[model samples]
Target: MTGPVSTDRASDEALAELLMRWVPQQRWFAHKSSSAHLQRLERTPLDEGGVAQLVALTVRTGLGDEATSTVYAVPLTVRHAPDEALAGALVGHLPDVDGAEAWVYDGPHDPTFTRALLSLVAAEEGAGSPAFGVHGTSADGGLPVPAGASTKVLGGEQSNTSIVVSAPQGSAEAPLIAKVFRVLSAGDNPDVVVQTALAAAGCERVPRPAGWVDGTWTDPSGATAHGHVAHLTEFLAGSQDAWRVATAAVAAGRPFSEEAGELGAATAEVHAVLARALPTEPATPERLAALADGLRARVAWACTAVPQLHEVAEAATARVDAVRHVTGAPDLQRVHGDYHLGQVLRSAERGWVLLDFEGEPLRPLAERSVPDLALRDVAGMLRSFDYAASSGAASSGAGGEGAGAWAAACCEAFLAAYAAGTGVDPREPGSAAAALLAALELDKALYEVVYEVRNRPDWAHIPLGAVRRLTSPPG
Candidate 1:
């Protein structure tokens, strides 16, 4: 006995109802609290002639307000029989689709989909329906990921799903890792674009990108918008993130100043290369004014979100003014927008390697394309050092007293090395560069305050402390 063929309209309506039930439970879903009324934007078939049909879909997760609505990229394989191998990746059951016994499985976990995903990318094919297109690009001489390769989905990812693909035919073959964007937006996805450029420029600090998928989708307003769908890169073997190494050093009371300095130098080199490789614009007076206002806005937001920030709000805004007064700031360049200990991986072969070129994940996609001061990355690292110290101290029971001094030492060492390479020092307490860095650091801390308040109230103390220390530094 087989179910009747589900008409295209009926299938979409059923799928929309299913998504309303399924998406909220997904880790990649953004709107956890708000009620979602999913509107299918577009659906493109990745592969249609197989036992399982793989389709890529873009859906709007909310209704009415354009600002409130979020777009999501959803890919799934519709098959006749339940794939016990992909049971864990199962999204739900679809009773009818092209007369097959539709059992829907998450795309990344579907072997048929993952295999074709890379092949499409390697072939650099642009395909889709009348309303939208999905394009793929593979680097010159890119190798193929064999069909039915063993793939595993990484756990604990919040915004996207990552799949680790291995060559099942041989153990010696290097593995591949692919990131599929869950939330979709038009324009540049720096994670794909920037890193791919850096890799093509022979930058060793970033993993070499093998291939990527970009897509164009019709919005509710019927405008075709483009953005990256996924990225595939080499999986670094025997690599550990710098956060773990940094924290271990602090926990054991071992000096991390040397490593910090090296990381800073590495960061500076990446910035230099990025500045050379990408577009840059002078920091015009108007841009500076807008920057100051943006900083002040963050401070205001933090003040409202975290009541403790209210007391120092005036002083925080004052730092923004100090930054505004500073003349001849560095030219805006394309650097790692979100640079921190966690975003770096330490490898015995490669040393300090930077990955994830996507700026701040929470920031709007359009804003990320505009180049900005590289000092923002500097401030982000400075904040990361503080978190590392705080965690190490808490774990060791050595208290924030020692942690503060250690963090200060590391910060100073980092700045000193970075300044040596960049020819612009941000270390001196009263210097112009220092003023700008302070303002930027405070803004980042305010961001952390909001994040910690919403996610980890206990950890809010770390950022709150930075906010206070920045506003009123101890003599």
Candidate 2:
């Protein structure tokens, strides 16, 4: 066992300098390209009992005349001895309260932070815990942590850190996966809202809700900001994401219509549950016009970001115009805004389990929380199918025609199943549903073009091809 390092916290000035250099490199930090200055506004400690301390820092970034602040919870672990496992995660050594220099590390990689997190969730208190002002609750009323539970942090997550807690032998509860949100927002996260609602309504299409961590803090301006910091859910062991499954099937030339159909059915089930659990509103002409405007704005922004979108700018506008002029529109309700194959899992026993309802990470929390056209989700899934086809073709060096055929088959089967489950045929031509679906599909493709250009330039052609297909006149 290693000796405990002294508990002297670094001064705010020294910490700010380190964070200024570190924040831009983090995957979850927004505004990376802008030249900005960071200032520490507040720091709250969630845990300081172990070899590490989990501290939530509200940092403000000022760029020119504009300024924005966000809360980030960083775990700073102090160690006197060199830890090989944490060598890569070292933040820097700081002077301890005991006048000894201690090695500090990023908390997520350390077992101390992970273990304390699980212990806190297992305690499951709504108020008055170590995380003062933060509320923690069990989604299923109570989540018992099995004795001798083992902990391991999962890898490759961009926005959040996830730790898996495996139950010991003969435990009643299943394994739990806890997601610690890196960038904090001042509102209830839709992931918690939607999953808890569905779980309460006995919706089996989602993983069982285990618990969540939330809190409120006053900003420097005296405005109170509420944040959902972390969430814990039942872990689905041995489940594979749909992207890997679909792309592999395409690469092997196997038909995926059956699985696609079942996935569509599962999506419809969640939609039905969300409609019942949350507020719903009919889609009026004014609302459709607003939605069209939103798409138009995105297209404009995308054109500015991705120069290739300039060719399709007029075509996208026309499609949005068609949606605005449509006579009747479907009802609007809360939806999975960023629905894609990767957001779903194919479970052997559960069929299909949906994950992540936080919507697009870039959108404001308010907009993401509002009810919207469910067809948006459908459009996103359709785009994913196209992406799978393109990716598989590239990987296997298959002809475009073969990949297109596979995508068409999946789209047809998935839409048919969704229609059957929801009593609305989005594939029906010349109908309001069809018009809305097409417009949303184009919007999603346009969004993808920008995202690909910015993040994965090589993959930009996939969505660019979609833009060309949607815009070109059908023979």
Candidate 3:
């Protein structure tokens, strides 16, 4: 029941204070529980009747005497009723600031933010300049926002924010999903680059991109503009992310044997498509050595943090060394850098559609973009199944045979489908790949341990149990 606040009249200090309290409450806030100091970096007025304001924030965390900084660009929409459908999308309640309600996100609400957002989409579709301004840079220097056919904020992603944008309205039946990069970092975002290439290569497993937006932002010194990827395309709708579906199936106690088989087959088909799309490169001794070294470093870290991972880490490192020279078909392809159940969608008609070409968030952007083994993606998916099962067990407080049975069923179904579709025998050369995957899972678990311990201490037990399972001897 509050009226709209004019962007020009709003005080930056008041906005910063509101954001500081608001950020810690978001599910995606990495340091949600930690104390933070907010500094306003930039504020841009949305063209949509000037009712919406996009504010970029640089927050410094106070850890003891040291303070570390992180930046977030949040778009806040001020409306009286807004839309009821947007209620679930609210990040936090705005302070008792007179008579206004503020809903903030990477962009405005789903289905495009007002008519102005739609206008940006139209401009991009026509290959013209964007109508909106990019924060942190002079309005004249920033890259124009791409025109979208249709747009909606992807629901259910717990990590980074994703917005799907299509070309001009009704230009084509198919639209693009331009994901705006959040938690900004230097270098080209792999997801933007690789997926575009895959689409060009006629890889059907990934959505085809119509265009992308990348530009430089002036640094604090104003000496040079650091490169950043703002958003890019290829959009789909009404598709359910695979992980959500699988988790629901398990929780409902419904057998996923058929779906697993289909998933496996779909995964194999995707590999085949990717193999055709990406260039192949030999796995040199130097590369293998580097991989081994990285694994060793991860093992060491895991051992220090989670003692249960000691045995698994040692075994995995040894196995990787053993296969260092055992070459089969050359390891070739632009892989789905961070493949997992959560990164795929199951279209009722299209089967499996992959998403987020961005590799592991912790890895350097260059490494994520480089070509790698197809098995790496396969291994990532297999680990996802394990994670899904484990998460279900933890949620329900069910352990032992019941949990094991459920996990095993899902594994069998998925593997059966993958093997039949891809023609790669899981028990043959793929075993080495599987073992390597197990090692990576351990690495992922260790990473999770640190993340959970810092962010959600209450949920730290999830990764702790995974570490125990990975290192424990088979029964």
Candidate 4:
């Protein structure tokens, strides 16, 4: 009922004032448009030395009756031992109270926070467990942070926090990057299990794991918390994320034939590795039926949130109907989960190196972990290509002619490359695979529409166009 509480030494009055201003500044803060009512759920102390003591704050915000609470791992610094770099990254400034300035940690930066993050990653590698702390019985489980390993926050990453860890003195390589998992879920983290398995299977698309960290803690409500990825892997440097390169190619009006082809080949190889490493199961009618049901539910949800998704919803349903008749061995292999242009990297010599094995953001952890059609990942990449083209068009103010042409060219090149590399026929008829892919792409775009409308109303058009295109009759 009262304003949100802060578990820090700062008085409730100071914390409330800080929360009111701070909630609107965060990228992840859900209720930015309305006034926030804050309530503190929990806090953890980072240091016991009495100097540079940091606090992680979990706060709940409400707009009248509608409310949602999210845990934010914020680190605070006392005025006497202020961290300049940390202070500069503050999301919102607390009014100077009693000669102390309270600053919130910028989820994107903060070295002290990075150090704590590294502890989790080092814990994973040293302990021979998954980088994320998911405690499954699988071989890729339980990564623990090493003693005395430190971390430096990396500068890039638009959606997640990546921390680079310096191996303790007298180690083999320079520093390794440990990407801390932000969103928490109850199921096994795909990034840890799948990528680790791929690396073990000699898949060249992902960075090798040095270590991982994972564990469970009690929530404020006293429920047993499930394991989540704290951090994983020390990938090679000097590589560009595939999304940026693809967007650049589109914006410059350059044909992405070579890049798309390479991407396709790399994707095929990734699937092969996944198929080999993960346990397989026959694709029963029940599993396929369930997938269709899930897609239908997702489309229904999207239609409610974004009115523009109606066309996509109908088309997707039709496609699901067409695929319902085809019954083949449903191969359940570990997949990349959330594959896209951004989740990949282009290395100078090794070609496409995929990053972030985390799957679809909306799916539950168990669903993401369960092996499904490899074509699902392929569909995800195809959708990403559309997103890149649209994003570039929107940014450059390119008209329909330019954007449409570029999107078509990229799609063709990428498919050709992928087909050649994976030995899958892209043009084969009666396969029903292409229809399945289109349905998935439509589903992904619809999800994006909901997300963008809620978080960024301006960018909603990108997904809206995709929905319309998928629903329209072939000309």
Candidate 5:
């Protein structure tokens, strides 16, 4: 066993210098191009009982313009003796509180921090210094750490660090996944809030909610800001994401209409439960007009950004007008804003499971929390079908005609299931619902066009075809 490490040498200034150099290299760091400067704002002990002390530092990331700087939580672990096993986790050597030189590490990689973090979250609280006004709290069913359990960090995550906790081999303790937030903002993470609520309401479409770590820290202006630093929930061990499943079926030349319909029903079930378990309000005319206004601007931008959109500009404008002139739009409610195949999982035990309700990672939390049309989610999923078909056809050496037919079948089947589940058909000719669905789908495709043009120019053709199809008048 390692001896307890002291933190006397890890001064805020010294820590800041090391972190500024370290933060930019991390996969979770948002600002890659901008030079980063760290101003240490708050330090709170996440766990002091273990051999290593897990110190939590809330810092303002980015150098200039205090108002625009983003808040990030940095957890650093101090160890008396460096373990060769943790060579990849090393931060730098720093002296301990006793003036003895010690080793520091990134928290997620070190067992000291990961173990303590899960334990504290199970207890639903990490008693940080009240003087710093920061702490972590858990909900009703937070993480429970069993004996002989080990944790491994999940990789390829761009925005947060996720650790999976499980017992020794063959043990029955269901595993748990914990997400430590790298970027901090001043609102409850929607993943925690929405999934917790739905789980509490006994919705089976989403994994059961566990809990989260929340903290408060002063910003550059000396004002208090609070946000979730970490979140925990149940992990479906053998589940596969929808993207993988759909693509496989497509490559095998199998009809995915049945599975697509099932997924649509699952999505509608989640939507229904969310409306019942959370807040909802009528979509006021002002809100509809504002949404239409945004769509108009996007339409214009899409035309300019993707020159191919010029051919469909008039049709796109007509759809936007339909949105603006609609009466009795669907009631507004909290929705899975970033609904795509990637945001869901397919479990053998549970038909279809949802994940990541936090919406678009790039959008502000406040903006994402606003109620929106459910068709927006419908639009996103429909686009995912198209993506799956394209990928599947390419992989299986099928003609483009086969890919288009598969996507269209999936679209029809999914929409039919959704209409049956919700008791509201969105495809009624000349109806406001029909018009809005087309507009939202066009908007999603247009956004995709911009993205593909910038990131994957060859892929622009996919969304451009969608724009033409969606904007064209019904035959």
Candidate 6:
């Protein structure tokens, strides 16, 4: 059996039906709950043979006033028989233009597509045709691609797909990893924008930029739209993320304060770099009130989704309101919106490298791109520590007291280091920083409840525990 002879409109229509079934199964797909009707936006053949296709889809989901839509780029490789390795990434079997059965595999998991992506990024190709486009630059303005480089897809990613490409044999250059953004939006991605700026500013706390890939397409409205589709960075060869390290330390009952302190300082350093590289603004009472309102909205939404949050709703709202009334709030600036231990890597050469500046991908890009109180990041990390403690205690069957103590110690140590580096005492009693941090922490925990409830019901208890404590009266 031969693969598709040509990727025409009819073939694309047949593939769209199959994609509706396949897309929702993917971990990176955004709208799992809604019924999706995929409308073909564009389909381009990457190779002259037409076996590999770059597809852009606009999925209209939900119905009536509840309707929503998102655009996605799904590259696919059509073959008669996919290799055993590609079995896990199979989209489905479909008939070719000649009506012969063919197998389709997701592009990021396919070597041919990955290589094409690498070539595009390396060559800095631009959109010469309506169907093809690419725009990216290396940190030092040069992309280096070693010959015979191969890609290995990473697992456990929730929102985006990533493939790690090895350096060519005996090459001194570090390995590269490309993150393919699942959801498509026009304009600069904060992950690429912020990391590039930080690297240019001589920041040592982020993976050096290699290059990126973007594409352009004519939307349903007949307007040209461009979007960042992927990003590449130097892969730390033998690094482990702080989440794994912290979990191990908790299980071993070892003090994680030293590492936590280091990570805190590293976070502060990144914030400082961002403040210098990007715009900064003083926080007014009005801004503080707006921030508080956002927090209250999140709490309300989360409580509606996970009724468990109802227990702590009032107290959470109160803490959030305290921020609006505070007289002196710290300056607002661009901060990592979804900071946690998992977002950091402990490299052998670089102590702490922050990854993923994309922020909460579920939020609108405009909201994620805005300057926020840096303490929001601090609050997220503080909540992460609690989650780690709770998970560790569950596995080890330790008492609640021990878990609480460990989390408290780690949070205290982390805050001390962060405060010292940034000159912001967020934990100081009755301070605006204290009120803001508490409110953010509460909001984060509530947000966690919604995620955990949807994804991992058993893990809901971890954040729910934090919610209870946050709402409890002071001893």
In terms of lDDT, model 1 sits at 0.79
TM-score of 3: 0.72
Name the lDDT of candidate 5: 0.78
Question: Mind giving the per-residue lDDT tens digits that candidate 4 earns over 1-475?
Answer: 0112223445445745665576456554444565555444223333232112222234555655776544433333333334566666655555553355655555435545545445434432221112212221222432333345555666655434676666577855545676655544554578877778887887778877655545444443545455554545755668888888988877777777778877888888888878877887766778777777888888889888877666566676776565556554336677787888878888896888988887765456677887777777877887788778877777777776777777777677777766776666544555555666666777778788898999888878877887787777755
Query: In candidate 1, which residue ranges exceed 4 Å CA deviation?
Result: 1-7, 50-67, 141-148, 169-173
Error at 17, model 2, angstroms: 2.8
Rate residue 444 of model 5 by lDDT. 91
- Model 3: per-residue Cα lDDT over 315-349, one tens digit each: 64564455454444346577777888888888766
- Which run of 10 residues does model 4 get worst, by summed lDDT? 127-136
Candidate 3's displacement at residue 102, Å, is 11
Q: Which of the two candidates, 2 or 3, achieves a greater lDDT against the reference? A: 2
Candidate 5 per-residue lDDT over residues 408-452, each given as its tens digit: 999999999999888657778877778788889989999999989
Model 1 TM-score (2 dp): 0.93
- Model number with the top lDDT: 6
Best-first order by lDDT: 6, 1, 5, 2, 4, 3
Candidate lDDT (C-alpha), each: 0.79, 0.78, 0.59, 0.62, 0.78, 0.81
Candidate 2 lDDT over 1-475, as tens digits, reads: 1123232345555655666677678776777776646544344334543355555566666665787766676656656666888889888765542354567678777767666656556676433233324556666653565556777778877777888878877877788888888777788899889888888888988888777878665543557777797888888999998999999988888889999999889989999989999999988889988888888898898889987778888988888778888877778999989899999998899989998889997787888999999999999999999999989888888888999999999999999999998987887778898889988899888888888888899999888998888877644
| TM-score, structure 5 vs. true | 0.91
Which has the higher TM-score value, candidate number 1 or candidate number 3? 1
- Per-residue lDDT for 292-320 in model 6, tens only? 78888988899899886777788888877
Q: Which regions of candidate 6 deviate over 4 angstroms?
A: 1-7, 80-85, 98-102, 141-143, 218-222
Quote each prediction's TM-score: 0.93, 0.91, 0.72, 0.77, 0.91, 0.93
Record all residue pairs in model 1 with backbone atoms less than 3 Å apart, i.e. clashing.
none
lDDT per residue for candidate 1 within 1-475, as digits (tens), equals 1112233776766666666677788888887766666555455567544332323344444446743666777777777788798888787787776555577777777777777677677667665644565778886544454445688887877888888888777556568888988877888798987887787777888887788888778665657778888888888868998999989988999889999999989988888888889999988778888899888888887888888788998889898877677777889988788888988999899888898888877688878878899999999999999999999888888878889999999999999999998987997667768888989999999999999999999899999999889999537
